[model samples]
Target: MGRKSWFWGILLCGLIIGSAASGKASDFRGNRWGGSMKQVAQQERAELEFRDDQSLFYRTRVAGLNCYLIYQFDRNQLYQAGYIIPPRNRNLNGCFQDYQKLLRYLVADYGEPQENQALWSDNALRDQPEKYGMAVSLGHLARQAIWYTPGTVIRLRLWGENRQINLGAGFFRRTQEETHPHSKTVFFGI
Candidate 1:
């Protein structure tokens, strides 16, 4: 019965390997990485706002903020997804508070971030937390955080431009980032 035992052992090995591979390509927001546009479109259940050669866009509300949800696909397979929130209000304090609230949600989902910091281009306002948002608007500061998950790399970015606070969250296939070096964004608008 040595041959029978060997066969069963090989079968068990195959099953284990398959499950592990699938785990490495887990789902993001219920949409599996490598899923097709047709598949995502049906599940999206929202009127498509725009479509380019390689991505799909939809408008939605998240965290009480109006946002544009983007899905980036390569070869018709999903590789990235995110939400872009437009500037809500021009108040400085309101901007920073919004950033903190979004950070808490991300931390709750992905645990502590791998990197969380306010990167400064100019330290003029570093000592003034009250002016942090204004500093960001003036191109003096930016807050960034990154989290690595089993099969995804999650990123949260908060910055200001032209006196408007901007917040965005991106979920990318871990493998995709490794494959594409020097990619600031999966797509131009991302």
Candidate 2:
């Protein structure tokens, strides 16, 4: 091989590697997607909430709301991260407002949602038991949104049922093998 050809070949390889590494998606707080949980905790100053064999839970705040950041790993590689907002205040409107606020914040960072939906139906209200009158009203006011990138997917949802408001943000790898392509695990009613 000629000297000039060798130089260009090496330069092209370096450019390919550099671009690939930089193009991966970041977690909600800007941590690298495939990095270790320890690195994430150190970088984000997150406190340990819980830990088991397969996942780690960290306490953090998003948009001034308490959030539990769950990190799911497969063979030591962080493949999924979830931002869970626990039920608070027992006010359906307040929960909806917080969900909207968080959605806007996510949009600012991740751009507009690819899928935004607000669903309501008389049947949804009717399906609930008579004892859950207020909850039926709240359940009729559900909203959900999703954003996608080549390397990650973000989902936001707000729904109320059984007198409890549920909301969350989920970030997941685009091609993880062990879990669903959408999210590591689904969270419902909490």
Candidate 3:
């Protein structure tokens, strides 16, 4: 190929790849925002359980982790979705491993999170035997990692206790409204 033709070909390929990657930001396992509960159920081939007027639940596996999903709707339009690790796999060490794996998968798909933090206070309760036992049993409550896209906010949280571990991810709509001022505003005479 001529030099000019090769340059144009490379540019076109780059654009196509960029667009495909960008399109994934708003999708959850091929289900995009505004998709209906019926659509998701059909896609997953799972039985959908209705929790209330605004929520639906189902079980599925994502990235090899068995999880239960809760889909929340506003006016019948899906506005939020959550993937939760099942209670059966709640060992503290196992939970941490699974959480790390999930985090890596999310980073690969969505790029780095906008805010990432991990917090633990093992020494805070060491002096108090009563609190220390509970604290240890409950493991540590890790800070969530959040990511923002144009119209969506994605959050990842992993936490557990001796008996139950919980790892979850939530995708929510990014509200467009501005926050109102704390104090009321007064208008001058026109």
Candidate 4:
């Protein structure tokens, strides 16, 4: 091939590779969760103390879309929130049940004192007949008595409007232990 053809070939190949990478990134961007992790963090007040006996970490990724996941234990509280980056929808039914069970166990272990009453109250988990702003949406599929895991009760909270501002939590334990406390306190949308 002539020198000019060689240069063109290299440039075309570079363009193709770049376009493919960009396309793959774009796919994640489209599925991006909407909302700000910061906002979600700021909105949630810690309902319980985090026990430090277990391992946990906060993970974030920004490809075409921005996402955050809190890997506490084996499960991940993942969030893809913010403006239209793509893939803006997240249905976490499985995770939701996990949290429901955890919360129930926590309430049982700690006893539903006034402070913890809301977490255990049927009205808080399941929507009340009045259907007001604070009414939580607990699906019917996971309703059961409390069952503890990790030899300790852990309560997690997840929140978002179409993947914006997802929340996670660890419940207060009777046994005191040092733990790394982390939370998303603010999120900005561009």
> Top model by lDDT, which number?
1
**Candidate with the larger lDDT of 1 and 3:** 1
Q: Residues 91-129, candidate 4, lDDT per residue (tens digit)?
A: 444334444544554455445422222232444525443
lDDT string, candidate 3, 50-139, tens digits: 446656676677767887666655566665566766545343446556767778877987789888876565556545644432443475
Q: Write the per-residue lDDT of candidate 2 for residues 1-190, one digit (tens) a residue.
A: 6533432332232110000012545544667766776776666668876666556776788878897776665566676666667656654446656887899888987789988986665454445444233543356656678777776667776665546566777666655424444232233221
Cα miss at 127, model 4 (Å)?
9.0
Of the two candidates 1 and 3, the one with more favorable TM-score, higher being better, is 1
CA lDDT scores, all candidates in order: 0.65, 0.59, 0.54, 0.28
The regions of model 3 sitting more than 4 angstroms off are 1-26, 39-52, 121-140, 161-163, 176-190
TM-scores, one per candidate: 0.78, 0.70, 0.64, 0.24
- Give the deviation of candidate 1 from the true structure as CA RMSD: 15.4
Enumerate residue pairs that collide in model 2.
none
Supply candidate 1's per-residue lDDT for 87. Answer: 60
Assess the local accuracy of residue 126 in candidate 1 as a C-alpha lDDT between 0 and 100. Answer: 92
Winner on TM-score (1 vs 4) = 1
Per-candidate alpha-carbon RMSD to the true structure:
15.4, 15.3, 17.5, 20.5
Worst 10 contiguous positions by lDDT, candidate 1: 12-21
Count of backbone clashes, every candidate in sequence: 0, 0, 0, 21
Candidate 2's TM-score: 0.70
Model 2 clash tally, residue pairs: 0
